[model samples]
Target: MSDTRLKISLASDRGMIDAALVVLGTVAEHCSAPLELHFLGHGLRDEDRDRLAHACDAHGCALVLHALQDEDFGDAVQVNENIPLVAMARLLLPRRVSGRVLYLDCDMLVQGDVAELFELMPQGAALGAVRDFYVLDQMRPGSERPEKLAWHSKVLGRSEVEGYFNSGLLLLDCDVIRSDRALMTRMTDFAAANDYRYMDQDYLNVLFDGRVFYLPQAWNSIWGRDRLRAKTLAELTWLPDAERTPATSKVIHYTGPNKPWKSQSKLLALLRGRLPALMKWRRAASGRYA
Candidate 1:
């Protein structure tokens, strides 16, 4: 029997409609379970609602929308320029829904059945997620920066290097999250008052700490891994060869500001978009020629 329980949640605002369309459209195309998307949008227009609903309906799925605003986050200071205020909306999503939910970022595309991740999830974690590239990069002695690691540890208020997980793709155990209201409150408060480089992402990592189920890197494969400074994939000795690209990744996350949807700009934009692709090729060719 087809699993009827998979529910995916995501957040975005009006400004990110184009990327939202791409992500939602792909989810509709690839999901194996009954499609139910719970979305949080701040200042969304009626026209945009129709567009999102259509993105789901195009593949015969349904979307339940929850309109959001800054006040929804209470005293939290919203000040990130690279992402919309709605990006923090996921912090409150567990209370809004029941059962397990897979929260996805709008900058990604689903290429396989994600329910497999739930099967892979271990017992007792409030959530499951892949470790961020920063965590992986930290494992490399040459790339390690004691000062930067210290900054992260200070920000997290915990020194667990493995605790960091990319918030882009989350498999949440809503019941567990709802039960931990005190931690949630403290995390939100800290995120509001402090300077966390990754914003709400850092807030979650700190609060969850050892409670997270470390997911396979394939489930949240980053398309443009900016942290990888190596000239070739082989030089990524810290990473398994299977993980260098989407060899088995079910979702391709286009992380950072330079999205495929955004039109090109100058130096910064150009480097974020093209350099990763070039490095992948150079790494492969160098191995072949050598």
Candidate 2:
């Protein structure tokens, strides 16, 4: 069982450590499977690492820390100059870790048994993820929206329905990544060729192309820019009717700029009654250890 325990990977910087702590605390509260957490970042201070290790220890989970510097990736990493180097950490997971691992963004909270997600992965799917709503909108341009460029298509020169998946939460088959150097090379090449609108996410969609297994939205409920456009999973036609409500969601992702931590942000206020779970995240972010 120890060998098969779920492995979770999180990448964080100074600004996101609090959010990461909140995620860790939430997992402590609801996740029932034996687990291991891997933290990747360029500036995880010794004290912070100690604190994180202690928190996981209290939860009876194991923690592994990788203090990486920007130079480690050479120039293969792609992100805005303003984005933290840690933003590229997910790209390194294939080479840095072993076995199947789930990559989760720090700006999310676990609300149910995470092992359920792990168990739901279908065999031969290199990765499993929920559809990114904003990307879906771009892919399915409508009345007011212009069609996406042909380059964004799976066929490259031709337009095809190549859905995009968010990288924020991924059930990765690390063995596949380790064995497929061509996949890694192609992703790096793609990153170097053009500036992606969504950083590594764009590269991931391009690299995987049609290989991704789209999980139910309930697994990774995302918060988009215009709440009116995607206030709930029900609003997205891409989502299955069965997984529509917040009550059924296993995770809530603060995907856009308006984070729950920004107590004063008007965007957070828009969440209104939908943010009771955020209160739990906030408590965890404060280092309360749930």
Model 2 C-alpha lDDT per residue in residues 178-245, reported as the tens digit of each score: 67889866644533433665667766776777788777666776543335334434344655653344
Q: Cα RMSD for candidate 2? A: 3.7
Kindly give the number of clashing pairs for every candidate: 0, 0
Output the number of the TM-score-best candidate.
2
Off by over 4 Å in 1: 1-3, 187-195, 226-246, 265-290
Candidate 2: regions farther than 4 A off? 76-82, 137-144, 147-162, 187-194, 224-247, 263-268, 271-278
Clashes of 2: 0
lDDT of 1 by residue, 226-282 (tens): 345333334556554434554455677877666655554546545665555334323
Residue 133's lDDT in candidate 2: 56
The local distance difference test score of each candidate is: 0.69, 0.69
Clashing pairs in 2: none
Query: How does each model score on TM-score?
Result: 0.80, 0.82
